[model samples]
Target: MKIAFYGSSLVSSYWNGAATYYRGLLRDLAARGHDVTFYEPDAFDRQQHRDIEPPDWARSVVYPATEEGLARVLAEARHADAVVKASGVGVFDTELLEGVIRNGASHAIRIFWDVDAAATLDEMRGQPDHPLRATLKQLDLVFTYGGGDPVVEAYRGFGARRCVPIYNALDPATHHPVAPEPRFSADLSFLGNRLPDREARVEEFFLRPAASLPDRSFLIGGNGWQWKELPANVRHLGHVGTAEHNAFNCTPLAVLNVARDSMADIGFSPATRVFEAAGAAACLITDAWEGIELFLKPDEEVLVARDGQDVAEHLRALTPARANEIGEAALARVLAEHTYTLRGAQVDAILAEEVGQMRSVA
Candidate 1:
């Protein structure tokens, strides 16, 4: 099958959190003998700070961030078996949603891959006439980044024909245990962009813990954190590239996973960091969220924390032997169940089923 995927950025993880997910899924799709073409807007300064080169597995097309560019991409998409437009394209999202439905209605299997399902649903609820809500029924399938039951129910409530949750998974080839880097070595490390939705959680889960453990070293690797004042014990490394994620994770004694407000409320939505850290064999400590056990068992595969005190206690009690055991357990779990190869097979099944249903109707 020939597939055209429109996402925010595939070549850079600068401010885009979906880069790893896209790379893994698309690469696996190509490996499965499906032709895949990725269309990404050339805005967002991603090209300026590109961390990875375009892979040969799939065709990567960078288009102008303009109407003409959209028209060209839409034309190409109409010729494909399936065309997917993800949320957070960072440019003319509503226009892209409406245009894809309008232009590819007959030729292509339209899909809205919502990387941020909770946030998208929140917006749809607030704005009844949001483009996604208006075009819900037009899409052949809706795929999400791990929103469990509530997210699927919400999309179904919005009249979507079919909804599937494609949770984030690790790409063992990309993320694995690497030698620690002195620059990123710390007792605890977190890598996430400073977005409005995540700032408060980062403060409560990360900063507060850092403050409580003044003697312990905490490192942060992300962009947009320079404006905020960090504690003395917490070191900030701005804009760590995707290639450095393994080293960053392995350098930390334990890594933290703090979900955004909507993700926390919706449950089961594990961010890319959770999988990456685990893949790098780092002891994982995460805030409480529903459906977490679906991915990793708490206190066995990972440590669950409710507040700063909980995080601090875990950090304090962690021994080298115990931390190694937890890290190994988490890595084993992710490698077995949460890799892109498995996710690609799931996607292949879903798309094949959709095509079969279409043929039956025809």
Candidate 2:
């Protein structure tokens, strides 16, 4: 199948969190003999900070962030067997969402893949005329980043024909165990681009914990934290590229996963960092959220913290041997049950079935 995906940057993880999700899922689909062309707009200095080149697995098209540029891409999308308009393209999103369906081949399966379903749903609730609300009914299927039953029901309520949660999974080839590097060495570390929904949580879950444990080394790696004051024991490394993520994960005593306000509240939504940390065999300490057990068992495969105090306590009680045990157990579970190979197969089957049904109707 030839699939055209309109999404955030695949070549850059700069300010875009969905980069790995696009690479892992689309790379797997390509490995299964499907052709994928990922269309990303050149915006927010992402092109200037690309972590990867155009990969062999998928054709990467970087278009100018202009109406003319969008038109050219829409023309190219018409030939795909499946046209996916992912949420949060960061430029002309409504045009792409409606354009893929309007310009695509009649036989092509139109999909709206939401990388942030929780936030999108919130927007729709606040605004009755949300563009996606009308587009939902026209889309053949809605694929969420990862919000189990609640997201499915919400999209269905908004008039989606079908909705599925494609949870984040490890791309073992891209992310795995690596030798620890001294530069990233820390008692606990968190890597995520600083954003509004995440700022308060990062303060409570990461910064607060760092302050409580004055003796422990802490690190923050991501963009937009240049001016924020930090505790004496904490280090801020601005914008660690994707190439260094494994080292960042491996060198920390235990990596932290702090969900955005919406994702934590929505539950069942695991960010790409969760799997990336697990794949690198890093003991993970995630802020408390519902449905965590569905991915990694709390207190065994991962450490769950209800607040900064819990995080501090976990750190105080953690031993090197215990961290290794949790890391290995988490790695084993993800390798067996949550790799992209399995996810790709699931999506492949769904595409085939959906296409076959379209053909039958014709």
Candidate 3:
């Protein structure tokens, strides 16, 4: 199958958390014998801070952030078997969504891959005339990163023909245990962009915990955190790249996963960090969220914390041997059920079924 995907940057993790998710899924699709071309807007300063070159597995096209560029990409998309326009493309998203749905109406299978399902759904619920809501019925299929049942049902209510979650999964080849790096070595580490939705959670779950344990070292790796005042024990390493994730994960005695408010309320949405940290054999401590056990068992495979006190207590009680056991268990669980290979196969089956159903109707 020939697939065309337009989303946030694929080669840079700078301010774009979806980079890992896109790289993992699209690389697996290409590996499974599909011709996949990724179309990313050249805005967002992603190219300026690129962490990786385009991979050989799939074609990566960066288009200008202009009307002319959208025209060219829409033309290119029309020829593919399936054309997907993902949320958070950083520019002209509504225009891009409409263009893909309009141009791919007859030939290509049109898909809206919402990486931030909770936020998208929230917007749609609050605004009656959200552009995406106007075109919900036109999409052939919808895919989400997380938000299991509630998200699916919400999309259905908005007239999405079909909605499925292609949850975040680990790419073992990209994220695995590595020798610990002295630079990133810390008692606790967290890697996430400081966004409005997630900043408060980071404060509650990561910064507060670090403050309570002043003697312990805590490291943060991501962009947009320079202005915030942090605890003395917490060190900030702005903009950790994709290549550094494995080492970053391995260097920490334990890694923290703090979901944004929208994701936490919706439940069942495990961010990509959870899988990446687990894949690197990092002892995981995460904020309480619904459906986390569906990914990793709490207290056994992962440690769950409701507040700063919980995180501090967990950190204080963690022994080297116990941390290793938890990390190993989490790693085993992700490798078994949360690898990109399995996700690729699921995507293949879903598309095939959709195609078959289309044929039957014809």
TM-score quality measure for candidate 3: 0.99
Model 3 weakest lDDT span, ten residues long: 100-109
Model 3 misplacement above 4 A: none
Compared with the true structure, the alpha-carbon lDDT of candidate 2 equals 0.94
Per-residue accuracy of model 3 over 87-122 as CA lDDT, tens digit each: 999998998898888877476689999999999999
**lDDT ranking of the models:** 2, 3, 1
Off by over 4 Å in 2: none
TM-score of every model versus the real structure: 0.98, 0.99, 0.99
The 10-residue segment with the lowest total lDDT in model 1: 99-108
Query: Quick one: best lDDT, which candidate?
Result: 2
Clash numbers, per candidate: 0, 0, 0
